[model samples]
Target: MDGYFPGTQSGPMDTTETFDSLVRAEFSPRTSYLNTASNGLLPARAVTALHEAALMRAEGRPLLPLHENVETCRAAYARLAGVPADRVAAGASVAAHTGLLALSLPPGAEVLTAEDDFTSVLNPFHVRGDLKVRTVPLERLAESVRPGTALVAVSAVQSADGRLADLPALREAARAHGARTYVDFSQAAGWLPVDAAQYDFTATVAYKFLLGPHGAAFLTVPEDFGGLTPVLAGWVAGEEPWDSCYGPVAELAHSARRFDLTHALFTYAGLRSSLELLEELGISAVHDHAVRLADRFRAGLATLGHEPLPAPGSATVSVPGLGVRQPELSRAGIEVADRAGNLRASFHLYNTETDVDRLLTALEA
Candidate 1:
């Protein structure tokens, strides 16, 4: 365990490994770009662990011992999210877990959520019935909470604008109206601090901030919440799986694990490795790195005589001048996401101070 949780030394291990590999491939010119937080680049430790797991799978190991990995990953995520291990559950994606929760709600109930939510969430809510959907301005989110609302769902950070939400306030409003709150922390996981024990339920994809693969996500359910249930449960979610008396009569697991209906041991092992790596690099450090980079980017954008979206203290900050045909910026190989007439730039730990400066210089040109 000491070897696994290397604390702040995790980055050094990666740095050393990268150095050694570079020595081996010294002659090869590399096009190094940071995409760890975006596409779930596994840390060296995690990659090694997953490789071992894959080898075991190739040998046809029975039962897979995935529960151990899942439990281990759950413990790490719980510690990071400020919740008990039992309160946390791992799934293929936050979308799957939240969708199960959404399905468990009263049919055709009004679910008040943000319009800027991630596409995974938007698609699920779109096909659901009895949805009284209202797109509220970011500033009026607190004022917009209404009575009889089934659920108040919002993203901790907007995937489009990279803005952080007032989660504490959102939680308060939902509780006041007797509505359950569900937060999508996909973009905020590694870059933000959250106490899941303080909220009704929170879901985030492991791939984004947790630095895991595509099929692993996590959800934290409040210790006591009756209105929300796990609609799509599986043998794992049910207790006494090996019991003779089998059927829907099986009792669900007494914790949030009840939300996990399908199991993917391969992905679970990979996620466990990633979670271990996250434990190594303390959340506080990771958040500081991301925020510093983002602040730098924001400052640079301002110097270019353009304003970012959502403003400072707004829900998010969409980059300016993305679509403009800037000669040097385009030639310099800078790219951004354009959505709803706004450009988006994201920041994370893998990003450096230099990256922001490069972006700023290119945009200025």
Candidate 2:
């Protein structure tokens, strides 16, 4: 498997040995873990971090102050999203932030989205009775933007098909219409470079690609954006949450922390550890490795007389004829998903050429 794909390195520094070694060291060695799009596998270090934090709390000697740990996790997510720490807020889930962002828009705002986009991206706007929601195909999203459209919401990557959205083009169209962009990067954040500065608001759940627990997520909002108010405000959203009880007037924080929700501290602890690991590995390397593996997997499927769905540069591949064989494959320790009628295998940095080989062998069987 060493030279299966020539010139697959993203750069001179990216070698298969280094990539595989890191994956082997950090991730749990499963027979094959090809379902990262659904939920990522936490590294051993992250699991240990969660256990230690829980133990410290049980012993009455916490690892660090809760606020300090929260800030640390927020900073880690900020770095991952390539945004300033002040512009990032912690949320319970992508849906929570999406609802918050949708509610922040002006009354009767027109929101343009895609039909195939994640429900979290569309449901928030659709539920607003005063807002005008228009659903179009991803290819037609840019052209669907019109005057008076206040927001354009979409996912960075389609969850089922793994189609990457053209955020730059969408942003350009939205900008021309004076509309803001909201992106859910749940499938793209860890394996892809999501430009947080390009969109007005972006969110991703930690449990999916960030290799952390559920019930905690990160949202990025522009620091200078005005006219947006927190719809789900709590004491954490106040300017001085600790002194909120004594204040006669309620004032929200000047930063994106104004949207913060009470988070699960244990989840944040695991997220901090995993984020640190990802940062150390460099997201570029992780992305390149995942993409390379996906390319190889697609090529393998093709050789097996199974042409995958047309999803260019996607880490997830969908084979046409394997949908019915999903249960058998899973029984054989080859994990994947049956998305509609397509059998989908999602790759991550943890997946290797050997994993692809195993999948191909199972299909042949």
> What would the per-residue lDDT of candidate 2 be over residues 280-337, giving only the tens digit for each residue?
7677777877888889888887787888878898888877667788888889888888
Give the Cα error of residue 152 in candidate 2, in Å.
0.7
Model 1 scores a TM of 0.82
lDDT by residue (tens digit), candidate 1, 237-340: 77654451356736877777776656677677788876665565556655655565666667777777777765343212475456453333435564444555
For each candidate in the order shown, give its overall lDDT on alpha carbons. Answer: 0.65, 0.81
Q: lDDT, candidate 2, residue 331?
A: 90
| Overall local distance difference test of candidate 2 | 0.81
- Worst 10-residue lDDT window, candidate 1: 1-10
